[model samples]
Target: MISNNIKIKTQDLNVYYGEKQALFNVNLDIHSKEVTALIGPSGCGKSTFIRCINRMNDVIDICKIDGSIKIDDKEIIDNNVDVVRLRESIGMVFQKPNPFPKSIYDNISYGPSIHGLADNKSDMDKIVENSLKKAALWEEVKDRLDEPGTGLSGGQQQRLCIARAISVNPEVILMDEPCSALDPIATAKIEELIDELKKSYTIVIVTHSMSQAVRVSQRTGFFHLGKIIEVDTTEKIFKNPGNQMTQDYITGRFG
Candidate 1:
């Protein structure tokens, strides 16, 4: 069942990169303050779907998006929509930890500085500290704020990227295979952080790890051939999916 507390709504969201349609007539209602995980084999349009939420596909000259993506009923596809503000409202963390070649403190403060969320050093400092604390990295890196972000361990770097995402106080955070490059221990920390983060921010994650999806998300969507074949509570999707294709994919058939 779709929740009444829908934070993001996508209707007939179709994307075409040049001549290839990457997504097909997709409709999804993402709930507020919840983690929704997208799972599928590669090339299933999972990343493309989330990128559409923030209009990231606009960068590609031939990327054509036809449909509606709304946050609180405000259509994001409108030509007049300020993409910078939109992106600030909906932050993204990519597959690998891609930290800027700046100090740890600078990395956390970059978004707030760009969006004018902080006006003074004190406010920026608080924002930086709180964001790191939220990502659970403050304790480890608090004294090393001057160190370059790129120098951190892989897991720490990914957490740093996450802190940067939340630094802007985004309404929603989109993570694309965020833990793919981390070790089991590092992945565990990121997973724990994701669970805690959903209490304050809506989150959407695209991961190939079915176990990760099961562990981190309340609702799970199974995508296949550029479409979502099934979506339901994680338990049901894993153990009792309604679609055979979904069952096949989850059971390690043809995914």
Candidate 2:
């Protein structure tokens, strides 16, 4: 069951890529301390919608957005909105693990240092340790924090990215097909991490794997042709969907 602690809300949200409408009116409520899965075919607006939550869309020159998305009752799309602060409050992990070329320690501490979240070297070390621990990568990398982040395997690098994101202590974490580039074992590890991370952060994941969605999410939203067709409990979305498009996509009939 989803709690009443809504961390983010999207009302009549729409997106455009230089006159090409990518998302229609997308209304969504993401509860705090829960995992919500967005599932749809490629080119669907699932990824676009998640990017909007953290203001990543602002980077694309052709991308334009309308409607309201609120975080902690604050409008994120408003002109005076602090985009830097908004990004700090909402962290994102992309489909591929994009660790910096710097040392593993540097990767985790980068955000905290930039945001002035750490007071000193000791504080920075503590932040790195706690974030890596929370991301379940401490056991593997605790002995080699100085090594380049790319030295790790795909899964470890992804977790390192997660650690970096969490180091800022963001309120919400957006994952866009985080396991797509990982092997089965690596994917499983990430899935477990997602289940645990939900205890502290609101998670919104866009995944192509139905089983992954069913396993890790409390709620599911089905998208098709740039519109959300159904939003419900994970079980309901998989076992019984309200929309035919959702049902078809879930049953593997068609994307």
Candidate 3:
């Protein structure tokens, strides 16, 4: 069992897509309420490692993973595990904003409704309000709650997705390049929101942008060729990386 201060810990993790291995002997620790960023070139297994946290790779039939992944000291990859509940506890936001084809109100309310989080209409309303407020979108969308979520602009839609993810009251939020699809202004907004969200939720993000990783993460892990080259404070990772590979990648010497 992990100590209370640690929110997540992975032990010697390995992932395979069919017979081809993508990640090898990956070990990591995530502290509560801190933001951890995974950075690397494409195909370096950064995203794959994050997906393993919540078992999201299960969505792909050929993907197979081996390791002990514990969240708050509970092993989540056990056989007969409740994947639905696991995912509910560990929410996710993707590279692209993917809100339901429903009203803004419905998008926020959907998760709580499905999870029986609210007892009645009034309770449901509160859930929606609180979630939207947490995502920094409530005030803007309050008057237009009935508006279709798709009607929102790109940044607003991404925030809506964040709101929807939080509606489940997750303890950990995994974000995969959440700002890659947005404009500079929208990306800045999301970065600000991420800084705020870290006050409550443990956030793990996979990012291709080194500056984005440096701007938002407390600890950054540099991965290459299915291995984590180094994990340290973001300041050290960028300014004084211990590994030659990490220095090379961050300095634009090579991926």
Best model number under TM-score: 2
| Model 1 lowest lDDT segment of ten | 1-10
Report the error of model 3 at residue 150, Å.
0.4
lDDT winner, 1 or 3: 1
Candidate 2 ranges beyond 4 A from true positions? none
Candidate 3 residue-wise lDDT, 79-158, digit = tens = 78899999898899999999999999999989999899999999999999999999999899999999999999999999
Q: For model 1, how does the per-residue alpha-carbon lDDT over 1-255 read when each residue is reduced to its tens digit? A: 234599998999899999999999888989999999999888999999999999999998999999999998899999999999999999899999999999999999888998999989999999999999999999999999999999999999999999999999999999999999999999999999998999999999999998899899989988887887888888899979999998998888973
Model 3 CA deviation exceeding 4 Å by range: 1-4
Q: State the lDDT at 163 in candidate 2.
A: 94
Q: Each model's TM-score, in the order given? A: 0.98, 0.98, 0.97
TM-score (C-alpha) between model 3 and the true structure:
0.97
Candidate number that wins on TM-score, 1 or 2 = 2
Q: For candidate 2, which ten residues in a row score worst on lDDT? A: 246-255
Q: lDDT per prediction?
A: 0.93, 0.94, 0.92
With a 3 Å backbone cut-off (N, CA, C), the pairs that clash in candidate 1 are none
Q: Which ten residues in a row have the lowest lDDT in candidate 3?
A: 1-10
**Per-residue lDDT of model 2, residues 65-123, tens digit only:** 99999988889988899899989988999999999999999999999999999899999
The order by descending lDDT is 2, 1, 3
Backbone clashes in model 2:
0
